[model samples]
Target: MMKGLYCLQNAIKWYEDRFCVRFTPTVIYALYPKEEEYGWPQPWPNPDSAGIYIFLDSNKTIVYIGKASQMGARLDHYFGYGENGKCILKDKRVDDISYVQCYSCSQEEPYACLSLEEYLISEMNPKYNKTGRTEW
Candidate 1:
C-alpha cells in the first residue's frame, strides 16, 4: 500500500511538473459501503462540484479515473443504485476516493480536469479505465 501511495504521490508530482499546474487532491477514506449497509457513511465528501475522481482499492492502487462536470450527480448515479448499479465500483470496491475539483476557464485551452484525468489514467494505468490506459 505504501508503495502504491508513493507511486501515486509521484504521479501527482509528475502531473504538476509536466503541466506547470498543481492540483491538490482531497482524499476521502472508507466511502464504500457494504451490501448490508444502508448507504454511504455520514460526512461524505462535498461532491457538488466539477473535477476528476480517482477510485482506489484497498492496496491504495488506483482502479479507475473519471471526470465529471457534476461530481455529485455523477457519483450518485454510480452509488445510488441508478441504472441497475452498472458502474465501475460495482465489483471492484473502492476503499477510498480522491478528487481534484476544478472549473475550466474556456474551450480556448484544454480543460484542467480532462487533462488531469487523461494524464493520471495514462501514468497510473488504472485497471478500470478502458480509455487512455497505457503500457506505462
Candidate 2:
C-alpha cells in the first residue's frame, strides 16, 4: 500500500511539473478561508508585508517554496487572471494554497523572508524552487 501511494504521488507530481504547478504546505492551507463566527470579510487587504510561502498538495508534500515582497499581492496574482502564463491557479494542477507571514527585522532593514525562503528551499530541496538553487 505504501508503495502504491508513493507511486501515485510521484505520478501526480510529474503531471504537476509538466503543467508548471508547484505545491507546498503553506499553499495547501491558504486555499480555504479560515472558519469565522461572522463569516468572511470582503475585499481582504493585500498583505503588503514581505514573506516566504510554501506550496503543498493534499498529501502535505513540499512541492514549492517562494519569497515575495508583497505576500498578499503575489498570492492574489496567482488567483487572478493573466495572459502570460504566470498564474498558478489557472494551471489547474495546484488544488490548494497557504502562506506564512514574516515580519521585518526593523523599519529600515530589508525583508528577511527571502533569506529564510532560500534556506528552507535549500534544506527541503523542493522540486519547484529551481531558480533559487541556481546562480545568475
Candidate 3:
C-alpha cells in the first residue's frame, strides 16, 4: 500500500510534466466524515481543499482514482449525495477511501491537479474508471 502511494505521487508528477499542469505534491491524508464527530451534517475538516483520492477494496486493490478542488464536497458527493459519484458508492468491491491533497494548487488552476488524477487512472487502471486503461 505504501509503495502504491509512492508510485501514485510519481505518476502525478509525470502527468504534470507531460501536460504542463504544475502543482506541488503536498500529500495530506483525508478521512471520511464521521457522524459522531460533528453531528448529522458533519463538517469539521476543510471541505474546500483540493486533492487526489482513491478507493481500495478490502484486499487493498485500487478500485478507483479521483480528484476535486473541494475535497469535502467531492467526498460528500460520493459518500453522501450525488448521482455521478454513485459509481464508487455502488461498487461493493470498494471498502475504503483515502486522499492526498494537492496542497499548493490554487483555485484558479483546477487543471493543474487534473493531470495527477489522469495519471493515477492511467497508471493504476482502476476498475471504476470509465475510460479504463490506455493501451499506449
Which predicted model would earn the best lDDT?
3
Residue range 1-136, candidate 1, lDDT tens digits? 1225567678777776887765545544444444553224433244655666666665556766777776666666545333533233433354344322222222333367777777666776776665554222
If both were scored by TM-score, which would come out higher, candidate 2 or candidate 3? 3
Alpha-carbon deviation at 18 in model 2, angstroms: 37
Per-model lDDT: 0.54, 0.45, 0.55
| Per-residue alpha-carbon lDDT of candidate 2 for residues 1-136, written as tens digits (9 for 90 to 100) | 1122244246435534564543221212334345641111223233555555555544546666666676667756556534643233644655453322222222233344555556555556665556456321
Candidates sorted on lDDT, descending:
3, 1, 2
- Superposed on all Cα atoms, the candidates' RMSDs to the truth, in angstroms, are 6.6, 11.7, 6.8
Which residue pairs in candidate 2 collide? 23-55, 23-56, 24-55, 24-56, 26-98, 27-97, 27-98, 30-97, 30-98
Off by over 4 Å in 2: 1-28, 32-46, 81-88, 92-107, 131-136
Ranking by TM-score: 1, 3, 2
* Per-candidate clash tally: 0, 9, 0
Tens-place lDDT per residue, model 3, 14-80, is 7767876655554243333233422223352446767666655444455677777776677666554
Error of 2 at 48 (Å): 1.5
